[model samples]
Target: MDLSTLMLLCVFAFTAGLVDAIAGGGGLIQTPAALVLLPQYPVATIIATIKLPSFTGTGLAIGQYIRRVRLHFPTAVLMCITAFGAAFAGSALLTMVSSRFMKPVIFFILAGVAVYTYTKKNFGEHTTKPYSRKKQLWYAFLISLVIGFYDGFIGPGAGSFLILAFIALLGYDFLHASANAKLVNMATNSGSIALFLLKGTILWSVALPMAVCNGLGGIIGARLAIAKGNHFIRLFFLCIVTATLLRLAYDVFVKN
Candidate 1:
């Protein structure tokens, strides 16, 4: 890549990591930017290269979140295990199938999520009524499997979806949900990265520099979220979801 192009990608990577650390739609920024800038590369290679930066960013965010939030270890562990496997399956499927069909479906879902979150003023502000441990585990498994698959397959907004699931299904507050989401997100990213490595699709020269910039952004963003708390996160979530909705709309209606 030329110096100017590399610099532009680094800027986008940092922005993506910052946004993603706070709300989980970093791919909205990073993936599209890479695809647009690095048109010479195969689409799969661009996607795979981006995953390394994503994984590193999520890792940094997790480190910050862990120190501030109380995570449910049992639930998180179950979710991570399921998510990893599901992500691997999903990534494998991506090589065989067109993901165009999923865009409209996800767009609608995100719309509903944005509306519900907006109208329900207290949503995710505090923990909801608790589910039994067994129920929580079951819910976590399902949420992780589905969102992890989506993460690997569709490749955007999976973190936000994970957070939404944890808050809505598992009765977690925003901070707790974000913390758990980071763990599951990390697992999903790792699963996809592993597959890409085996397939020899990633361009490490691009991914490595992006990863450093992304990680720095992740650290700052996570700390900001922790300091700002639920209201800030809720607003950030809405903005990210809105952006994802628009991007998907463009893809489904205009691009296609």
Candidate 2:
């Protein structure tokens, strides 16, 4: 990499580490940085590089969240299987279709999700669960399949959105939902990484330092958020998701 690109990558990697550690949308930081810094880079490589740091960031985030938030193993397992399979299929199919075609619709979807969460007064503040295992499982299945496929295909903010869906649909508090999102999101990233490895597009040099920094960031961020408690995390989540929505919306309608 050139000096400019190297500097850019370093900055992006650090930002990604911090953002991902806090609320799990680090890809939104690093992927676009790759696009802008390495304009000549293949789209495939851009995608693969994203997974390298993310895997590290999320691996740490997962451990941190699990330490703090109690998990429902059965639902997490179901989510993992479905998400991994769906993401693999989605990534394979992604090359065949143009993601740009869906940008407008996706913009609307992001706006709606952001608005929905903002409108809810106590959405992520506290746990208020009331359900049977069977009911939660159905939502978990849908979340894994839908979000996982989207993650593999488009590859941004997948973790945050998964958590939101888990909270809204399953009535999980933000903390538990975040823990669950980590499990399912791991599968999505793993699946996409597997496909990218097959494509031979990853650059280990760019990915290695990024992964280490991201891992440290994840550990620090997760611990801080847990210590700070629900209200701070919820607001922080809102800020990142809203920022992502704006960026994606602009990328879709204006930039295109």
Candidate 3:
């Protein structure tokens, strides 16, 4: 890429990192920035480049969260393994599934999720009873498996979906849900990174700088979210869901 374009990409990565750190939808920003800047490259290459920044950002955010809030280790571990395995399997079968056919349905689901959260009073504001360990494990495993597969096969809103699943199905409050979502998202990104590596789709030059920018953004965002607590997360989650829904609508209906 040209110097000007490269700089633009870095800026986008920085912004993407900040958004992702707060609300879990950085791809909604960084991926499009890659497409706009590196129009000549394969989509996969653009995506891989974003990964470098995303992983770095996630690592930073994880550290930030670890310092302030204790992560649920068992949930994190199970989700990661399931997500990793599922993403691998999904990547292997990527060619078989067509995202266009699925996009409308995904959009509708996201719409419902967004609406439900908006309308429900106290919807993700308070921690409810912890599900039985076995139940939580099962839900987390299934969610990771299905959502992880989606991340590898056709990626969009993977983080948002993971957060939504944890909140609605597993009954986590927004703060814990966001925290748990990162662990799962990190796995999803790792899975996508490995597959993109196998396919040789990553543009390392772009990815490296963007990764640093995105990492910085993640660190700042995660720290702020941790400091603010659940009320802030719930509000931010609604904002992200709205943005995600709009993105899906444009992609599925307007652009397509």
Candidate 4:
């Protein structure tokens, strides 16, 4: 990549990490920008290259969240394990099958999520009554499996979905949900990265510099989210979800 193009990608990566740290739709920014900027590369290569930066960004955000947020370690670990395995499977499947079929379904689901979150008011602001430990573990497993697969396969809004699941299924507030979602997201990214590395698809020239910018953005964004609290995250979440929904709508209805 030329210096100018590389610089542009870094900018997008930074912005993506910032938004993703707060609300989980970084791929909407980073992936599309990479695809647009590097049309010479295969789509798979671009996507795979993006994962390394994403992993680093999420890792940095997790570091920040760990200091301020209380995570449910047992369920979080279960989710991470399940997410890692599911993401690996999903990435393997992606090499064989087209992911185009998933876009419409996810579009509708995100629409519903956006609507529900907007109307519910106070949703994710405070924790609800806790589920039983068994139920929580089951919910976490199922959520990680489904969303992690989606992350590895479809590759957008997975972080948002993770936060949503943590809030709706596990009765976590926005902050705690985001913290745990970062953990699961990191695992999913690692799984996808492992697959991509095996396939030798990553563009390290771009991924390395972008990773630094993204990680720096993650640090700032995570600290901002920690300072601003749940209300800020809820607003950011809604915005990212809406943006993801619109992007999917275009891909499904317009691009095709």
Candidate 5:
């Protein structure tokens, strides 16, 4: 890649990290940016390359969240493990099936999420356990398995879906949900990146510098979300979800 193209990818990665840290739609930005930047590469290669920057940024965000926000360690760990395994399996599935069939389904699901979140004013505002510890763990496992697979196979708004699931199923507030989502997302991204590396699919030349910028953006965005608190995160979450829904709609309905 040329210096200009590398810089552009880093810029997009930074933007993606910033948005992703707050609301979890970074792939909506980074994936398209990668497609534009590396048009010659296969779609899977671009997806794999994007995971490197995303994983780096998410790792930083997870660290910041662990330090500042309270985390449910047991649930988080269970979900992380489930997500790791599920994502690896999903990555393996990517070699067998095309993801195009999944796009419309995901688009509809994101639309439902947007509508549900919009209509419910106080959703994700306060933390309260709707389920017992064991039940919550079970729910977490299910969520990690489904969404982590989606993340590895055809990621766009996986983080948004995770945050919503954490809020609705576990009764976490937006801030706490976001914190847990970051850790799970980090695990999923790590699994995908490992698989991509094993397959020799990622472009290290572009990913390294972008990873640095993405990590920096993650730090800034995480701190900002911490300072702003739950209300801000909730609003940002809605916006990102809406944007993601629209983007997916365009891709599924208009682009193809």
Candidate 6:
């Protein structure tokens, strides 16, 4: 890549990491940037390239969140384990299934999340454990499995979906939900990156520089989110999910 192209990708990666650290839709930015900037590459190569920066950014964000927010280690560990396995399974299945079919399904689901969150007014504001410990573990595992598979299969809004599930189903506040989401996101990214590495699909030269910028942006964004607190996160989550919903709707309806 030329210096100009590399610079532009770095800028996008920085912005993507910031948005992703705050609200979980960073791929919504980076993927489109990759498509436009590196159109010559195969889709798998583009995704692999994208994952390198994302993994680095998410790792940094996880560190920041862990320092500021209290996490449930048992649930987070279980989710991470299931998420890694499910992500690998999903990536393997991608060779057989058509990811196009998932677009509409995801659009509708994101739409529901937007609506439910909007109408509830105070959803995800306070941490309230509505379920028993066993039930919470069961729910977290299920969410990680499904969303992790989706992350590997289709690759957009998975973090947002995970955060939403944690808030809505698992009765976590947005801050804690986001913290947990980061851990699982890192695991899922690692799973996908492992497969891409095995296949030799990643564009390492482009991804490494982008990863540095992404990590820088992630650190700043995670600190901001931590300082600002849950209300800020809730608002940002709504905006990112809405943007993701619109983007997916365009892809499924207009672009298709």
Candidate that scores best on lDDT: 4
Q: Least lDDT summed over 10 consecutive residues: which range in candidate 2?
A: 98-107
TM-score, each model?
Answer: 0.98, 0.93, 0.95, 0.98, 0.97, 0.97
Q: After aligning candidate 1 to the native by TM-score, how far in Å is the CA of 34 from where it should be?
A: 0.1
Per-residue alpha-carbon lDDT of candidate 2 for residues 24-77, written as tens digits (9 for 90 to 100): 788888888888887787887877877878878778888998887888888889
Q: How do the residues 1-256 of candidate 1 rate in per-residue lDDT, one tens digit apiece?
A: 8989988999999999999999889999999999999999999999999999999999999999998887778777888889999999999999899898999988899899999999999999666566777877888899999999988998767988988988898778787788888899999999999899999999988999999999998999899899999999999999999999999999989998
Instruction: For candidate 5, give the lDDT of residue 102.
Output: 90
Candidate 4, residues 171-206, lDDT tens digits: the string is: 888998888889999999999999999999999999
Q: How far is candidate 3 from the true structure (C-alpha RMSD, Å)?
A: 1.5
Candidate 2's error at 23, in angstroms? 2.1
Minimum summed lDDT over a 10-residue window in model 3 is located at: 90-99
**Which candidate model has the greater lDDT, 1 or 3?**
1
Better of 3 and 6 by TM-score: 6
Residues 4-105, model 5: lDDT tens digits: 988999999999998899889988888899898899999888888888999999999888888999887888889899999899989989978988889898
Best-to-worst lDDT order: 4, 1, 6, 5, 3, 2
**Model 6 spans with C-alpha error above 4 angstroms:** none
Candidate 6, residues 1-256, lDDT tens digits: the string is: 6999989999999999998998799999988998899988988899888898999999999899988798889988999999998888888788568799889988998899999988888888776776789999999999999999999889778989998988878888888888899899998998888888888999999999999999998898899899998889988999999999999999999998
- Model 5: runs farther than 4 Å from truth? none
Q: After superposition on all CA atoms, what RMSD does each candidate show versus the true structure? A: 0.9, 1.7, 1.5, 0.9, 1.1, 1.1
CA lDDT of each prediction against the hidden true structure = 0.90, 0.81, 0.81, 0.92, 0.89, 0.90
- Give the winner by lDDT: 1 or 4: 4
Candidate 3 TM-score, C-alpha based: 0.95
